[model samples]
Target: MNRKNLTHKAGRDNAEPVGGGGRIRPVNNPREATKTRPAGGKDAKSTGIDRTRNFCIIAHIDHGKSTLADRLLDLTDAVPERERMEQILDSMDIERERGITIKAQAVRLVYRREENGDGGEAEYMLNLIDTPGHVDFSYEVSRAIAACEGALLVVDASQGIQAQTLANLYLAMEQDLEIIPVLNKIDLPVADVEAVTEELVELLGVDESEILKISAKTGQGVPEVLDAVVDRVPAPESAVEQTRGLVFDSHYDAYRGVISLVRLFDGELAKGDRVQAMGSEEEFEVLEVGCYSPKPTALPKLGVGEVGYIIAGLKDIEALRVGDTVTKVEDPAESVLPGYAKVLPTVYSGIYPTVGDDFERLRDALQKLQLNDASLFFEPENSRMGFGFRCGFLGLLHMEIIQERLEREFDLDLIASSPSVKYEVVLQGGETVEVTNPSDLPEVFEEIREPMVRATVICPKEYVGQVMGLCHEKRGVSVGMEYISTKRVQLTYDLPLGEIITDFFDALKSRTRGYASYDYDPKGYVASDLVKVEILVSGDPVDALSFIVHRDKAYYRGRAMVEKLKELIPRQQFEVPVQASIGKRIIARETVRAYRKDVIAKCYGGDITRKKKLLEQQKAGKKRMKQVGNVEIPQEAFLAAIRI
Candidate 1:
């Protein structure tokens, strides 16, 4: 089995058993794992620049990006019908089951025009990159936008324009790429095509005639979508003689080592050519160069304007970063590619091995997983969670996906602490410090500046009041609010990132009946009345459970946290005191009473003095236990206390 299958198997073995009496099969068919090569390298070489078009599909979650990609594959006939499966680009089992794409997948298609058609008889190459839809994976979408010259902006006819759709549209515009607006899912009975088209026209400032209507599920109007891409989307401009390529994505293969998915800009890269990474400055010989025809297909050479994969027999995956530029070792490009932005993690948390002895295994597993996930970051941290790694992610969803992958793919159980946003502290000496964890805050600081974001919520007019109220409760400042259509409204607010990371989305869904869509971008830091709230168990502070909150909400948050802790913690031999405190003063407290036993059950026929003596002895024993014994907190309690 390949490494991917092995990882899937490890996850299945460790998780709860499926409904049936058998293990779930891996997504890829083991029998079809052989290496494939495109039709001919010489033919691909003869293909001209005008015949190539590179673009990506961008939309909100559950808006049919993957389904549209599947239809495009079918139109291009890249993969045979017998071999094709649902969500072919989503190769991971978890993604398939969840109906979401976690990683960006690329596929190259060959489109041949008929002589009798409107266009001349010729063959064209189309490269399509599928991106994740959730806001947490916006960074991935941005990277996808950077690689292509155009994008297919897909929107659900039923749902209309959403928060992520607008975010992606703006990102594509920033990249200066031509966008082809598409209204998908016209086959659904509830799809209001006219309403959606109007919304798109109003929001995008595009002519009504420019939009294409299609149903990715039934393959309706898919050919028209492809024709629009060819006629409207501009081809890549030719580059200089020196070889230049951008590594947009990568994955580790047990059989072939690290394989990089790249878009060639300037020159051609043959199978045996030596190349160096501009960022890491590491040189290696290209063992194999290939393109994805729904599967990895080896090629003799990847010419300019082509999207393909490169295998350099690289043992260290760090050398091949997502945004790094790859060039010929001997004759490098004059300058590296522009728009290479380093991914900075915004959310921080503590991840610990469920079993202490699995530390080495967990570390090695994380290192392996980090090979493909450049956005992931970690460093050793010692806290109440014991010796574990402090991990940083782009957002909460990113954090959850990494944690789940670690548990499933690595065959290890893990515990993750509460997620936090980075805080800037201005010290008394006028020195600035950035703190990822509340325990790392300095004792004396003049001001604490918390990261804020410009959050946008797109919803029906009925939910405007609720959304505005929710924003106000989170200490948000209204930026702007306007009507996109007769019934749809767009509300913008500036809110602290800390508030959004903690159940804001869930609360929004609850109040808006799941009709509201939200997105946000960092707006730098602002001075705030922030205090480090710490949770104490029997008067001892738990560093892992400490968090920063506003002074006005501290008392309420403290009370809620202590009450939750009291309920989650098990009864001990002595009364356990759970307190929420800020520095030396306790804001709220709760107590878990000790388990009492009948110490004088057999003293019914005995004297009253004898029963009293027995009870006294029991009381003394309980006091001793309370003085010396430590509270053994369960893992679930950590999750309960983390919400605050």
Candidate 2:
């Protein structure tokens, strides 16, 4: 399987039909131009559920999941040669620009098994799901895995196993999915195939022979991997009881409305059928249904064990939530599918429009974005930055994606406040409340408890001391440590989620020279000596600029904050005193000198009395202006200073 012979550089040649499970017909056009199949062509499958295979690719960030998916598509001839593009599944501009999969994309591939001394060749339908490799999108990965019966555990041959690789594998194991170990990038110059093979065997407890080696870049050994998927991974089990489909992912289309990526568990979904969402109890007529032929190709119906999409003309994105079950309206299933746990937002921030009048537009954009993103949570908020939405996200990357989408897709100029973690505050009145916005925090509290995360960092043994020191400086407690391999050590710590949400990951990457991988799970809230550090601009306390910090780091944080604010806030008519305080006590202060001019310059060479009188008048004017003039902080200044 050489890359040179795969397809033309300009893609002018028409793709040849592949001989597989079913007849592979050439569409010779984009998905939009392809016509719908006949009445029973999709639903009338001669094969049973035992012949179908559904699985996803799981790996660490940049471990080549998308590339491997491209090779599989090529092997199965799922995508046409003329229109084949790099990262076909990662359709979003942001996803391609960042070189990361933000959403899980599903595509159906047909593989024809060569008959061993038999008259006819048998074909198998392989529904391969491509998932994101970043920890921020782990929830998306989980939902995709739920729709699969097995997974291809991909590991980088050069980097060996990483934190997220193991994390994703554990998730698949939790779902009881059959696992197939694969070593990718075998063609790279620095690839150590044998060493990575041993690591996979030790970490996954799989036999060494089970590991398949391939170079997703050159399409080497990809067919063997596909064959292994058909041989090793078991087929999906059928349920004859009733109609049930798991809504793993979805997106909006202006013409078609909401198109949900679903996996049919029991019966079938067809066009013109009435379907109901078990969670929201919303019902709509199925406008269309089909599998992704690299695009939405309309089908008559999707049968059991099949993975495809359903369009129900849903205008309200909130009507169909991810992880909800969709069943027939008249004869619905008695119980819902074992849906996944809802993903909660771990980081919080304020998203405001720079121009005050764009508030409603921002609100509308967020509402539309939230239609596809289930983990994003938001509500209306009033602050110094004007009326905006206080939104929550999975992590820093997730926050960044939402911000970028709002700006790019909606053409919005947004002000994103610094990311903060949820804090548990216990008031003197015996009320415990979880606060995401620092401005929403009450004045008096009996105790302030901050969320903690159990973080696991895997790195080379030589960097253990540096990693441990970094964690300790962040106020982390060493929970556990062990050697994953002779040169690799896994270190676990309990640290404040606030600390982890900051520069911890970047620092870890730097200290380990990009060899360290890290992951964390929330460990709930713990009592801490924490207090709100307020920032006062020109003798006025700005609630939006306040932040909660541990008492031990209070002075350092307050000083750093005041210094940053000094650099950000411009000089006013009067000397604006920037102060950081805990309650009424000011801990740090900085000043922005007033812009002054020579008001007495024109009175030169005049009488001494005249000059003195002019000076007196100028001083009086200055005093009066200082008493009445208000400090006007620029939008940029607010964006810079309030992030602290």
Candidate 3:
């Protein structure tokens, strides 16, 4: 259909018929329809399986995945003009402000195709999943890819391909999903469409003509993208006969309980039906069934090959997981579907509420957030800072986003410990244990193994030397290097994950002038001379300030920590010494001078004997105070030490 003629009029009767005589009835007011829609009666007819297309958009950060989604919605008239906005699918405030997609979002669009000479016009159902581009949220992309049959591989025409582009491409290829190459941001003044097309041709092994060049910002050639999806992408195929659906995503609703977004593989699910989560083995009566046309619109039932949401009044947050399988309780599937692999957090930290009384509130907030973010892992623990939770995150960005959400959404002030990686400790008894917190490290260990990752750095050839220098400083070992194009190069190295988790990305960006793109995969652990450095204030070791570092660099890191602590700790009535030690050996030390009370000031003109007597008495009092006085460490000191 022509782009100009693709508009959907609200409340219009006798709408055009889709394939198999299904009508394309567009709901003008979704909120009203949701409230008035009946349960299990006069349900909307399902479009034929042959006319349904399920696909997701995958790209590097800021490569315009969300922009392209907006254009598609505009072309299909899926969103009302008054309510339309840029990055509409990014529902979170943090996402819109940062211009990134943290969570994967799914929306259903209805498109009407033009009639050919021999065939009549037909309406097609397009299900589009917009996925995040950052490496930390790659798990979300993987789950989205599993639910779709095709992916739109978006590339920036001016920047060509990037590290994440290859990473996401490999993910889609693993699922054997059909990939449609598209070059975005072609309207830029310096956009080298030909060069990028050549890069795409070499990487995808597709002809130059196969790549679609369009400017998502201006809505140029967006309608053609929809046509390509309908013509090139295949329909979903279900092998199972019994009812089965994949719960690709879910979130906790305070009013409705846990609402799950699922892709139906076989059979149908209707409101009031009893469904069971294969993973949790929990059954609940379905309270509602609907689809997201940018907004929740209630439907009577969801059919095979259809994507929609299910509200079963699941009060237990753990009852429905993101990668679980949902099936009818009465006629359940013989077996559970192949769910996604469990993602383990790579970075660890201690998240403690600023107010100790908010511990339960923090726990409740985390439980609700975990319901939405399956990758977040946490457990209760006690440290010198009092009761807190040791949380695990995918990466530093993921950690920042979660902490930010907790503060904004739950109104809780929190302090996060320095990010650390899991380490393997082998004891003298020939036993090994995992250590995520430095304070948990044993007093004596035979050896320590630190986690490592295989990192990929893509940049211009001129900056290759700077990138390599930065990597080498982080203890990286070069694996290989090659030229992806005449002007761009790709560098591969193996570096410790602990090193990359702290300031590595920022250093790389500064060294490359923000032209480098980085991605990494875990390569397990390797034996290293690791030592746990303990920070002591006034002869007392602060467990919260301890950290693990390589033996060779322990002295320098310890010195830096003590120096920073000296500047942060407040002056006390008695001398306070800050020291960094490894076991019994002291590596670094700094002192915060005590506040002196001039006893001699009162006897300025007195005899020498009287001044001496006053001085002796003052010295004796100071010694006594030093013996019994307690030094209070401020919160700023802890934050500074962790950052250092």
TM-score of each: 0.89, 0.88, 0.89
Better of 1 and 2 by lDDT: 1
Query: Model 3 off-target regions past 4 Å?
Result: 1-47, 117-121, 593-604, 607-642
Q: Whose lDDT is greatest here?
A: 3
Q: lDDT by residue for model 1 over 1-644, one digit each (tens)?
A: 01121221111233222111111111121112111323223233464666788899999999999999998998888989899888889998879988898988889999877756767777888999999998877767777776787899999998888888876776676566788899999999989899999877755667788889999999998898888888887776653668888787787887778888888876789988989999889999999999999888998898777899999888786778777889998899877775345566779999999788988988887777877776788998888777899999978878888988998988988888778889999999999999998899988889999999878798989999999999999999998887777778888889999999878998999999988889877778999999998899988888878889999999998899889889988999999999999889989999999999998988778579999999899999999999998897777877766555
Q: What tens-digit string does per-residue lDDT give for candidate 2 at 343-435?
A: 678888898898999999998888778767867889999887788999989888888899999999999998777678898889999989998
Please name the candidate that would achieve the greatest TM-score relative to the true structure.
1
The runs of at least 3 residues in candidate 2 whose Cα sits more than 4 Å from the true structure, single-residue gaps closed, are 1-48, 117-120, 600-644
How many backbone clashes can be found in candidate 2? Answer: 1
Q: What's the ranking of the predictions by lDDT, best on top? A: 3, 1, 2
Which sequence of candidate numbers ranks them by TM-score, best first? 1, 3, 2
**Candidate 1 vs candidate 3, lDDT winner:** 3
Q: Let me know the TM-score candidate 2 reaches against the reference structure.
A: 0.88
lDDT of 3 at 342: 66
Tens-digit lDDT track for model 3 on 1-644? 12122222111112221100111011111112122322222323443666788999999998999999999999999999999998999999999888899999999999997768656778998999999999889878887887787899999998889888887876776565788999999999989998888888777777777789999999998888998899888776655557888888898888989999998877689999999988899999999999999899999998877899999888888889887888999999887766766677899999888789999999999999998888899999898777889999989999989999999999998888777899999999989999999999998889999999878889989999999999998999998887888889988899999888878888888998888988887777999989999999999988778889998889998999899888888898888899999999999999999899887887767579998998899788878988898887776776676556
